[model samples]
Target: MATDPYADPKLEGVSIRSLPKVSLHDHLDGALRPQTIIELADEIGLDVPSTDAEELADWFEDQSDSGSLVEYLKTFDLTTAVMQSADGLRRVAKEFVEDLAADGVIYGEVRWAPEQHLGGGLSLEEAVEAVQEGIEEGEDAVDRSGRDIRVGQLITAMRHADRSLEIARLAVAFRGRGAVGFDIAGAEDGFPPSRHRAAFDYLASEFFPVTVHAGEAAGLDSIRSAILDGRALRLGHGVRIAEDLEVVQQQGDSVLVTFGDLARWVRDREIPLELSPSSNLQTGAIAAWGKNLEDHPFDLLYQLGFAVTVNVDNRTMSRTSLTRELALLAETFDYRLEDLEAFQLNAAAGAFLSVEEREELIELIGEGFDA
Candidate 1:
């Protein structure tokens, strides 16, 4: 991989890593450290693409860069393979939070399908419990380091699978225990959120929050189903929501646009769009627009009043963090610290926490940025 501008760079004379941020669409399976994967795979006698950590990291980036969604999906097979065991799950969960804290994240939600971790004979409950244990441990470590951080699971159901209702129940059952929300992830094109109406119905009845993976591989209808059927408060990588917009022209530092009903509603209603910059590029989610970060409709969405929040969909695959993602966006759009702070505030408000807690996070972000 070539050099990343924000790998460890400072912005406005302050390290972007030092400013507070919030991550809403991160994946537990996609944030593992390369070295952790090596050790975990070795313990389970699983073969990896490379033995060395750096080489393994490179392999992930290479495979993900193929621009084929199928190839991008293959990278998860390697990650979830080693995560089937309790120890592997716990360690990865612990490191996930630590990494988030290190990157100046005050709050984050790590979403993963519990069903996929059952190959090692662990029950769904056991998998959730194990990850919870690791999360608590990670929080303690960060606290001892004199920083505050919290993580919650967005219990996910594979959209193509038949376990939607079951996973919905699982997520609701773990509420206030470790799980904070529910989600449906996986092949979004054919397996629309409407396919799991029963699950969404159950979640809605129980008053549990849901975020669906839509508008990434698919387009507007997928997002509509995600909102109408899934009843999702947030759209995971809803970048394709841009499809609903008609850009008339781009003037100097301004854009003229028209919105379809769907786009207008999402914007006016303030439904959060969890946009991941690098992952969207790598998975070809933004291919319709263009290939580079500047081509991303993120600026347009922000300017148009959509509740946009930045994310790192897969940290390892994209080799990115929230810090790096914000940096790249700043470089692409010439955003200042206030622009970055606005993104963090959007995420904090959209977080699945109590209103009071979200307010506190907002204050924390203000303090961090003001410092």
Candidate 2:
């Protein structure tokens, strides 16, 4: 078994970090190690809020807990500032995969907007190649350590920007190289997916897999646009889909509810909801439900048969990992091994991979959990 550096908060006497997990919504720019940020920032002569690694980590967490997605996103400015060069992007991407492997992630898809990293004279193709080189290096490093991990890139575009079509082409251009999928992230409320119709049309024509950032800072309209216009195969933090559900009666896990058309379609179709427990709370994505982890609609959605998969959207900002997210959910909702396994299976099924690869991942999860 691979050693887990962040192993803690054991479930049923088993370290949650030792169990296999799948990360579908993790951000490459958002998962940098604080020390790496400090080093990279110094190399680029960029000023950071804190030179000390621990203080920088605390700064990111404090800034992200502000109960607004826009405010929470501001911290990324510092991280992305340093990621403007090939070396910076490569190092960050490498460490991101290494960290995920140490946290027991067997398969992960690292998502980031390539357009955001072009400030340092890197063309779109060069930027993607740098990150891909880092990903391959990380996978090899894990293999050398007697463990195995696989990570793919989800090339993303900023929804507020008009480069979605260009970025979509960039993603499709790199298919089978490192990019596995495409996404549009950033300020989900005012900038709905409908604004990027041209990119979505192109992506749909190419038959590329997509997952849109919706239902986090926005309500059902954004999610509806993501499905209708963007044709998102999965939702990034689709927690707000709960707003479409009207609860009629509830007692423990047995609750009767009325599902709005949107929620019904998402559920009946088994569309995966990339639910991030801590990041959701920090960004107030779950404020409609309550203010605590226990207040999250995850349990409700899971019980109602939504394909709910746990994720750590931003590890540095949230100071979280898939292990920590699973631990928090298990503690809050009293879930067992089987419940955690179910979440991984859902993520595996929703992953942008061949059906055979997903089945292989599923078998790995079952074996890991059963052990």
Candidate 3:
């Protein structure tokens, strides 16, 4: 629906990139800068698809667009390969925060599986501290540049692996230090959140927040498991939850729809749906709805009062930023600045922060949009 999906636009006389935002579903390994990836890969003697930074970036985008989950996952193999050391983790996490700040994120929770990064002989706790150090450094840099930004870690466990409970303990151990939440990010179909019930129960016992990657690679059953078994407070790219809704009819500005129990609960509970527009298209998460931006159920969910929040699930792979995602949604749905602000508010509310902190972020968003 955008004149050019790649072009940036002004929303109600405001630059979308300059508006304050909250990123809740961002991935650490999935968001490397192309040049950084090339450099890091070279440092580890790993051969990449392209030596040129831009070429490598294009390669990632190309691979992700293949509509094959196996092909799409191969991109992460390259990213994770170079991130096996403390230095690599620190640098990547630092840049992840810096990039989010540059994209107007006031607060973000970056998620990555610590077990995947332990190949460098770093313990789970060490890897988390490394990322936390980088996050602090990035926060300081943003503050020096006259913009305040903050980021927290969401320690992730590979869904198909056996270390989820260990990762949960690691996440809870570093709560105030950096880690704010726990998640499982690998395969989501056969490996449902139900498999990690032990980890979820542990996190719940410690009162730690959990957000699961469901409704992306799977369907409604996966979403149900995320809530019931994982007790997920927020869903990572929970777009397919749209499948649980049945549209009755549209009467100019108001549409009547029927909600399945799952849909109704998710809506009534105001559980945030971390909807990544471009990534959803690339990963076929919205294939059931349609293939184009115009056909995305984002607007439908929003109109029906589902707590829909925009995100860039993989900035490099999808070649998108939160700003770009918001711009695309505005173009497709003809949304105004107020709508954009509402989405940000939803994200702030769903963030793994204290009520006071979320209120602070909500106030910051209001001030930014009013500028």
Which candidate wins on lDDT?
Answer: 2
As for model 3, its CA RMSD to the true structure in angstroms is 2.1
Q: TM-score winner between 1 and 2, please give it.
A: 1
Q: Write the per-residue lDDT of candidate 2 for residues 1-371, one digit (tens) a residue.
A: 33444457688788888899999999998999999999998987888889998889889999999999999999999988998999988889888889999999999999999899989999999999999999999999999998989999999999999999999999999999999999999998899999999999999999999999999999999999999999999999999999999999988768999999999999999999999999999999999889999999999999999999999999999988899899888888999989999999999999999999999999999999999
> 2 or 3: which has the higher TM-score?
2
Model 3 segments beyond 4 Å from truth? 1-8
Clashes of 3: 0
Off by over 4 Å in 2: 1-7
The Cα error of candidate 2 at residue 281, in Å, is 0.5
- Provide the TM-score for each candidate, comma-separated: 0.98, 0.98, 0.97
For candidate 3, write residues 1-371 as lDDT tens digits: 22545445688878888899999989999999988988998898989999987778778888899755556777898899999999999999889989999998999989999899889899888888888888898899989999989898899999999999988998898989998999898777799999999999999999999999999989999999999999999988888888898889989978889999999999999999999988888878788878899988999999989999999988989988999999888888999999999999999999999999999999999998988
Which stretches of model 1 miss by more than 4 angstroms? 1-4
Ranking of candidates on TM-score, top first: 1, 2, 3
Per-model C-alpha lDDT, please? 0.93, 0.93, 0.90
Position 46, candidate 3: lDDT: 88
